[model samples]
Target chain A: MTKSNEYTDSSRATVNRRSFLKGSGAVAAATALHSPAVEAEPQAAANVVSGATTITLNVNGGDHKVTVEPRTTLLEALRSQLELTGAKPVSSDGSSGASTVLVDGKPVMASTTLAMAVTGKNIETVESLGGEDTDAVPRAFVKHDAQQCGFCTPGFVVAVRALLNKNPDATESQIRQGLNGNICRCGTYNNIIKAALDVVKGGV
Target chain B: MKNFEYAAPCSENEVLQLLSDQSGQTELLAGGTDLVGLMKKMIVTPDRVVNIMEVPTLKNIEAVDGGGVAIGATVTLDEILAHPYLEDYPAITDAILGINSMQLQSQGTLGGEILQRPRCWFYRNGQELLDTGQISGGDNRFHAIFGNNGRSKFVQSSRIAPALCVLAAEARVIGPSDSDIQMIPLLDLFRTPRQEGQREHTLLPNQLVTHLVLPPVNGGLNATYEVRQGAGPEFPLASAAVSLELDNQQRVHQARVVLGQVAPTPWSSAAAADALMGQPLDAQAAETAGLAAVEEATPLSHNGYKVQLAQVAVKRAILRAAGLETGGL
Candidate 1:
């Protein structure tokens, strides 16, 4: 079947709907503070019953009330539940660092951090930096072919974003040290570093 | 992973209460770097986990007024490397940076790294070597064919422990009851495996390590040099960390030398330290100290090469610390 025939307008609409729902989740979460006390009561009750403690996570100028298990890793909570799949899970073990996220303005392997442990701090993932239109890292990644299987892309992107945010004018050695936690088993370190440098050079 | 109960207490009193309430079945979760990995591997199956991340008193880095820095148990290795005080203490920073891999550095806490289980293939594999209680296959070859003392034949995981020993750091452990804080010399923390089923560190089930206090460097050049087989998911074959306090004329005043991946604990070379104490840090002095450090080394059938490599590392590290070129020593 032709590519055009395979993707019907209905499938396109379904994709759009999913994106809209995700966007709506973000909006609802944003406006949650101004929500009426009556409406907030049910949400708070839901969170308690869902085995999630109320965590005041400030991310990119927004506060989110996410419910999570006590032992739930910050990476798993961000991806599987919050749909913030920016931090990829390269290895179930925390060694590969496909799950790097910033907590309280410091980068950490989210896979090794329990979600509830970071209850009162700020947590930032790749999505916090790159909106759909203004993301330079993802675009440069495509230009440089920094990703192969695409499984490790989100983590690299998030980690680089955190590094650049901390040090926008990072030297090559600094970039290497900053990104040392992340590993690309496909041997794409050169391209990945180049992409990161591209962003730094462009001052993006 | 089994479902476990978690508690984040705010105060030391509360933490003690939890430990007292759930002594045997509970595991303290600091950075969760090693604990989570062990849980995934099924090496540990705790029914309850007590998270001390929220206890602000336990996560601090403060100066001790006299000299030295107190690093909290939950302080990440990245924090230690970036701390301004560590700049004055090169040996501490060198060891912290030697962990090298960013992922491990970010999540591996100073306390957790020191307390982490040995990286034995048999223990990590879990099911295969249940009978032997070792971490590798009984081929006793490949990863296992090294300077193993037969009982818990595994390499120590932390690169920083040896460095800490060289700096004469002290670990402050909070008791299971949380009423008193005990300061133990870092060297005493590791026990021979024969005493306790091959686990080196002497941490009781309910006790928690609150911080590591690094004494001040009086006036010495300190350095750590490591030699790994390769830089991927493997521990070092031989490594050495040396701290030498120098007098006005560059004569050694006090010396601490520690070695890693050669024994179960951070092996201190008192003989090596004694050799360098009153002498100038020259080629002759370094060679004497290096040779003295490994004189009693009993290598496994396949690991005799480690003695030579460790001696070389000791020589290079001392040379580098002394600001001398390592000229084909």
Candidate 2:
């Protein structure tokens, strides 16, 4: 097992998963309020974040204790600190949703979200999907040949999964609106939409 | 983005204290959709970042008395779009939906939406402002036409502000000067930046938007229409939001018409409202109101097309609000 301090390419993913599970229970209450009963954020008046500090980000069902400055976006921490490079960084402005991830089961642009802001929140990335068995999202993408360059595929998959997870009966218009956040420069939108629709209709 | 000190204040009081201490040097991090991009472009490099995402008081969206909605400043655009009650205010919802993309809606907050920076290419490229301390006339195709009297011609980018203005909503603001929160009409919140160096909002750097208090719809017909360059997430070239309260005869009793992307702020047209008052809600009346709305529009060199687009948007919005089938104009 890699030590928590080191974030090398080989052992980055493993380190977070092992350490995260142990500490997740303690910080769960401080995270965002899940639906049906939305509540207030934890009131810790003394918790002033300044300078560089070690932040525990619960990502992909793993606890990633990474040291970062306040300006480090969740996208930066995911790619550089945890070595989860599935989500692409196409635009600094987040006009392209290439760095999308699920925050509290909702699709959010990881590039625009500060890592420290989502310290205790549940963050699901492309890495968490299609674990041992290939999931339906990836299967449909492969079946439809939904990607040309594949730069935006991960974000699309993550976005589609989050959309279906929330609204399984999403119509074509809703699907289009939901996935509109992501952009594919190669113009694979038609195929990508087909892949999502197929998964929605249980075609794959 | 430059390295900055970060603070995720859990309470409103803590945030106020941080703002007091850091003042102009601190930038509040709500959704970070616009601020992060600005930072990456070096448009703004604050010394400290105060992350207000965890402040629960600033994230509430409760229905206010008299059938209005009191939206917490930190409420995300997605949350507002998903609310079932917002359906009554179609103009506001449609305008909010037309902004950016789904991912941006997910990350953008209600407070931040109204306070968006100018998206001019010259400004974004870090080109120096003109000697007059404003954006002098150049290639201003995407700039404002109505508010072009000033040197800065950058069109205001907030899609929500125009809708909110038509709805007659008010903004709840908390500042260091006031012991309690202050409520100002949403329209008064926006200001034309006189010089290039000036910020867009009337609020001070230490002031924070706490909530957006929407007035009761009161059985008004409301709608919004936008003319975008593409079907994708591109910003609108021209957009309009209108609310109409009709009498027993279906004649317009009251009207609030507001246009976007043609001015430095959401431009409200009293002339359009006056033209529609006591007039029969018909195509000709809507057309007249549209024309009246753009009478004051002074188009920049390359943006004469925007005036026509703005007219169409207003006309269509008024017709749609009245449940009239708009024949292609």
Candidate 3:
């Protein structure tokens, strides 16, 4: 969990395009491109970055450097690059909590979050929860049999842990509201809720 | 997704310059919840993705000159929900709670929520925005009933638009430079796309929504009531937001009622407001207002049920704002 300044990938991974115009927000002026094809008028803002670039991500209290494009999501970096595969990819819309990970203690859908956008964030995936003997969330899930297909178990466990970490005394209704982000396609919601409740009631 | 370049500008001028200087298309990324999904489906393929979450100016939530609050565009929904100054505005908070998912509330910004695109199945599946023929013939159980004027049948997809519109919120937009700023009503920002180049919003390709200003409620009480289908992070079936101020006799002196998921934009019903203007909020008055709200709704073949739902939402919103019993969940 100590901070590591090591570059996992030393080379500044080349991106497809290079940086463009940069300036101030309050006092500085900006120039507009003449074309209309790729223009975004809604809320045009970002550091001009194109092609692949090496960026460091701090996940599970450990910093891991990875090269990613603008399109490479946090979930992609966690699973594909860093091999932190606890977060699942159930639905692309990110409504499913299967890709849920806590960034700075907020439950966010990693699949929808671009890796470059969360470069300096504190990410905690399900793997961050210690071994089977140490984490009570997984224990509660096992005791309550909160899985059938088991595809959504890791996410549920992580999401439940996150909820409990924030609200240790979260009631059943609060648990339902808190964990609504994660869905069990196998219809294990009843058991999942029970597991969360067990953890809340100190039964786990 | 396209191999688009990404930019994370620090200042407003920098973002504006990138929006204009970049030859190809550039999309602003705030939460990336809705935009990423669209990009993955190839519904929108921008050449450059702009990350505006880190911009210092767009991150403020402070009290404005009026007793009202001015929230920066990048302020997250959960942050707004937690703000003490907004406690009286249940219309906005209730709508945010109705958003249902913590992930969305944690990541989605007020500007993103107000400016999000439609959830029309056809549109999401890659059909044109004005593809009225397919919308008319396809499965449109969740489509619009009031503002489907053959140009576009897709309903406005923002969950909190009705609430913000009823509050008469003003959006502050920044163009190419600081002098090129425009402050328009929040509702004025939306226009159903008529052409391929046009979008749901009226913003020029270079403009950015810097912040939003909500006028003080003074002695007004506001509430939002939504008729959701069921549990687990789904869009509302119908919704109504009411911002009302009553006279000494508990008679409605001012009323603003706006409906959502029933039209192309947040449909503010003057008739509904008029129905409540002189009367004390009661079951009969609420019923009358609700009926007036949906009287002009022209339901499509598959979705006549939404008219009744919209009516119920209006009735409940008024009753809730008056602190009266809604009588329905």
Candidate 4:
């Protein structure tokens, strides 16, 4: 058996196995495969728009040419590159629902998806929820005091708008479950749920 | 977050070539729902991220030849929940829906959710096991109290894993070579941490989980139950997914009991499954199985409540799947 401290080629062979028992061969092979790539290529500059891949994204109704790294998430691309700050980065992780956007008519966390991955798909953000005339969800949000710190309102509005578009007559329970992913740290959940119900019931 | 080179390969062969060329330093990005968070937290700093979304073959959901389902690695959780064929497999769909939040379901791919890293506090907080001379003070409160099996104490994060385990799903992995396709049993996807190191079964730098194949549930009843502490968005304290295959005589033919948030991986108890086998899935059988499932639980100082909670979850899940209400049990 190879000592754990020493790197060996056999360790690389067992890379597929979940076990941590690194033999010499697997380590050597893994090292050989990985080391040369870093040494051969220079590190790419971060946040540089030049030399990045250009993808056509149809946001709302208009098309926008966004240059993004392959690793750039849809959330970052929209907020940083496109200057559409409607979808706030309240929760860096996808769980908070603060960065939610509609991709192909489905609500998803912009932070959890790669910008390049959604090429050729219909993408919509909070900016697209309301036409140039007037927005319904944001009005309901303001009327119901749904805006606390205002960081999570855009995501909530976008989520509720999508939910209503899918099921205009959605029940209160369905509305609750649909908006479960978007959290309100300020304890405005009751009002938020009421706002969604108000729109669904056609009371607003 | 450290800077890294990124590539989107359109084919499996191209992915394999990239993995072969940059094995250890390269990491595969599926949905980035989990990977991006970890990268931002500096938990896993890779030199290259090979995004696999551009690979068309890995993004399909097809009907298998043997009446089962073949879900590609890139199949989103939203697609799985909305698939008409998955309605018959209610247990998996229930688990998928239980993840509940539309944001995650939309962005979280089935493959990424299955392969996500653990949510252990120590691991997430970046506690170094080795004494790296940076900290002169010995403050081991978080590191010592909740740490399990002595090593890295990160808890597994995927809520769907236990459900998939009970369903006996098969994970197809594509490695550095064209001939490197390997099918790993879902049961072996997790490993407990050693006494002084990180948990095993964490995906290696090169391997990509390409697909998950779930066998058809002919007449099995399946259900999942989760207990969240305080109702905010967080990992479950204890969750259980149970599936039972019944014969024409109403006797249990085969059963699988998987409990999550209890151990390093989704814990599968043969004892629990054995307790219900050859017996009718009545109230008594389910109670006995629930108690048998947690017999080997080695709870930490603060997590002792998990043992009883886990047993109750298992019992409730089994009863729910069996379609029996425990009104007075």
**Candidate lDDT (C-alpha), each:** 0.69, 0.79, 0.81, 0.71
| TM, every model | 0.83, 0.89, 0.90, 0.83
Candidate 3 yields a Cα-based lDDT of 0.81
- Compute the lDDT of residue B2 as modeled in candidate 3: 81
Q: Count of backbone clashes for each model?
A: 5, 2, 20, 19
Instruction: Provide DockQ values for all models, in the order shown.
Output: 0.12, 0.23, 0.26, 0.18
Computed on C-alpha atoms, the DockQ of candidate 2 is 0.23
Mind giving the per-residue lDDT tens digits that candidate 1 earns over B1-329?
66577777655445555563333367778878788878766677777677777766566565543566667788888778876667667777777776766667766788888888776566677743222544333433323223354555555667888888888887766656534456778888886565333346777766667668777776667888877675454467778889988888778988889888777677888888898988988988988998988888776545668788888878777887887745553
Candidate 3 per-residue lDDT, tens place, A1-204, comes to 111233112221111111111122311212211112223344454446778899999998989999998888899999999998889988887978799899999889998999999989899998877665568888888899889999888878878887888889999999999877778878989999998999888997
Q: Write the per-residue lDDT of candidate 3 for residues B3-101, one digit (tens) a residue.
A: 898888776666777775332287888998899989988888888877889776677665543256667789999999987767767899999999888
**lDDT accuracy of residue B307 in candidate 2:** 90
User: Relative to the unseen true structure, what is the C-alpha lDDT of residue A186 in candidate 4, on a scale of 0 to 100?
Assistant: 89
Question: What TM-score does model 1 achieve against the real structure?
Answer: 0.83
Candidate 1 fraction of reference contacts recovered: 0.26
User: What's the candidate order when arranged by decreasing DockQ?
Assistant: 3, 2, 4, 1
**In model 1, which regions exceed 4 Å deviation?**
A1-67, B20-24, B127-150, B195-199, B230-234, B325-329
Could you tell which candidate, 2 or 4, scores higher by DockQ?
2
Indicate the TM-score of model 4: 0.83
Error of 4 at A194 (Å): 2.1
